[model samples]
Target: MQPFVDGRYNMSKGRSAEGFDSLLVSITSNTGLTGWGEMAPLGSFYSAAFAAGARAGIVEIAPHLLGEDPRALTRINRLMDTIFRGHPYIKSALDMACSDLTARAAEVPLVTMLGGQENDMADLYKVVTHGSVEEMIANARRIITEGFHRLQVKVGGKVHDDIERVAAVAGSVPKGTVIFCDANAGWTTYQARQFVDATREIDYTLEQPCVSIDDCLSVRRSLNKPMVLDESVTSLEEMLDIHRKGAADGLTLKISRLGGVTKTRQIRDIAVDLGFMITVEDTGGAEVDTAAMAHLSLSTPEERRLHAIAFHQWVTVRTATNAPPVIGSRMGIPDGPGLGIDVDLALLGTPFFETSH
Candidate 1:
């Protein structure tokens, strides 16, 4: 699926793109149920994942799951890890498909399979893509007018540009509206520190200002704003390290980075136990990806659930339905069985791969 603004609007890792693309994996169970999954990398630069690598990984792992019980998500995830060594994002598609099938087997929604729903709806947030101060301010104003209370202001450019852009957005948005400046690990420790120092008087949150946990920790000491870790928190051990060190004020937990809902749930549980604020999301994707994230967000306590987005809303294609509706400032999970959305086989075209056991 292509983003509305293409690549000019989304910026990270010193790269920009015209549209986002993803690899979709569909598993057809013997019970005649189909489970869908999506793994989308934002032009291969935002994260370690790329579309090509994900497809190759799936080719290497799919045969192993040919006849395995779809409900054995843990076993499946472990097997994929044992075989692939790394590339959790690639394995995420399979994990999501298995979990979807498991929920279908139980005749329940994915959120119910995850756990009893703690939130009837999920709050939503918007991203103001990296741009000039005026453009970002305009974006912020538009998002706030649309009833969104939370905004993620993309930073990570030159320190002065980032500071000015952030300040502009803050000035434009309503007072008390939540604003987070996400650098996407685009800055050095010094740049991050400088921005934090300059923005000391603003009511804005900082997210992954630098690329490394150590660097971010160094900058954290000088900032009074809440700090959120995104690109740097990739593994369970890393998460534990952050928890042990009190690394940041919150986390941006992506389903692709941690594998899928199974591992994400484990991490979410830990985050809740540590009393850390958490937001669930994927790297980038269409409806399938959003559905998985929505269900996970639904299971999280509202107070701790920062916000999640239906990224598909930014795209032009309709891959699945029953996705969580964005009701004003909030989103809700679909009540349909399993993922609560149906993949449109027609849109997928001819299968690039197919096998039956």
Candidate 2:
């Protein structure tokens, strides 16, 4: 009762080495309005379980979406929300499916429909380079050549390791490059302060460095390093409150987590009005998801000069058997309607299980 895809890619072990057999998800609707999405089920923790749950949620709500206007994404989304409450991950799948389908149906890039004007440029950000000083330096060098002005490194879990990695990567970075750290809720505020102050030279933006949303607010209220909320600021109100409280100077807008593009734009406006910086980011899905995010990025404001979008580079491999949707790290939206992207249904995936249309 699910459409699953598995493929091979050389995943980076710690910026230098590579791992193989990476997997992804491709979701399609019966309307022939198909789309692709990724489920991060292999990242060493809940990624696997999380991805499975998302697939299950899609199965649970598929019947409700059958024959419905995928463009009326909110219709399916509302039903899924009310019918299957408390399954955020599953909601993510359904939301992404709708977005993917909607884009195809309208034949407009997701970014354009999401409200981006012409000539919108999106800058991509890669995962934090992990490993030795040499590896970190190498990875940073690679991304810089790829045209990413900002590099978001992972940290906040191991205080010393974070310091070491950021120190190494920071020094290795070329001049005028922006460096940001994503802790994934791995640090305490006190420790966060020390790390933030230390990495000040790296010009690192604090991203979920503290586990507690309140603590993040505490740090934002107290410090000047500019906290970026990735895990937090889930909804419109959350975005509003964070801005009102002056809690975060920036917010990372992830499509999969926040429902869909319609809602994504609301948060973007809120961020803009509050004078908080906003970057349309990824949920680390495959090319399609990256496309979705890119569309959002192109549609979002460039005043802050905030952009983090790169599709092919982020993934270890391609799932789309076709010429992987023509997209760029700074892909501009071609004039059209809706989330203009197609799912190569022929490459829906090698079947693990059959899902009848």
Candidate 3:
């Protein structure tokens, strides 16, 4: 378990966490090569996924993955999908390991396998977890001082209070700094309207104001600022649906939520073609997951890339060496093959579950 740096990550609907349960997986081939993957759900309430369920699913699926060619990414993912239904969160780690393994086999970075490196450094955004008006402003300013111009302000509390928080933070930041008021699916359509109307003059984007697509669309209709959808967008079909309905100006692409790099890359391509601004990130994890997020973000065109998170920076543990270090507000992908970081087995402690043919 990795403790959150801020002590607790408070979000909407009473979802708060002192730490997150991170699950790491490693796959070794006959030729003595290995690939790493990780998945860390925010909490049971935040999504349909939880740590125990992911671990259980992995245990059931791992034995079947033996002897499969890691380089055959599509085939491997298909096999996993065949064995398990609906639980994309469980399949994410295995899919990531396969991608890492494939990239290492080709002696290229994972970004190369995705498309190619399009940005030298992917811009990062800081999340201002739900807090008091003063606390949110202070946290936002602190991260801004660290050179992060983009901020995701966690709202979805009382409509009036959220409006005050967003307005105060926006007022505190420097001109041109981007502010995203992310509710994390915490508001009802009525409350979303109240918040939006109150902050109508503030320059910031609204994100996932409500829990459902229908509610989000209704809110978006009245929203003047750009609206970005998260949590609610769990699949390519949902993304396409959002695009079709023009429900969101942008969407957050969480690698684990969308299964893994394989399916994520597919959705990313389609999103780009459809012209959507994207924030590429994961549910949560240490170095391994951060590496995957960075590679994918780097491969995305910079103009459309809103920002990506350095999730490793949020946790207390170090899961890998040679992990990409955040220099100011931007992070560069590591210059090594595969996910570009070496997982520290020592830090990982011991295997929770193992299988062999």
Number of backbone collisions per candidate = 3, 14, 0
Q: What is the lDDT of residue 24 in candidate 1?
A: 88
Deviation in Å, model 1, residue 56 alpha carbon: 1.2
Residue 74 deviation, candidate 2, in Å? 2.5
Per-residue CA lDDT of candidate 1, range 52-140, in tens? 88888888889888888888888888888888898899998888988888898889998987777886778889999988788888888
TM-score of 1: 0.97
Report the error of model 1 at residue 49, Å: 0.3
Give the Å shift of residue 58 in candidate 1. Answer: 0.9
All models, RMSD in angstroms: 1.3, 4.8, 1.0
Candidate 3 ranges beyond 4 A from true positions: none
lDDT of 3 by residue, 242-311 (tens): 9889999898988889998999999998999899998889889989999999999999988889899999
TM-score of each: 0.97, 0.80, 0.98
The CA-based lDDT of model 1 is what?
0.85
The C-alpha lDDT values of all candidates are 0.85, 0.61, 0.90
Q: Alpha-carbon error at 27 in model 3, in Å?
A: 0.4
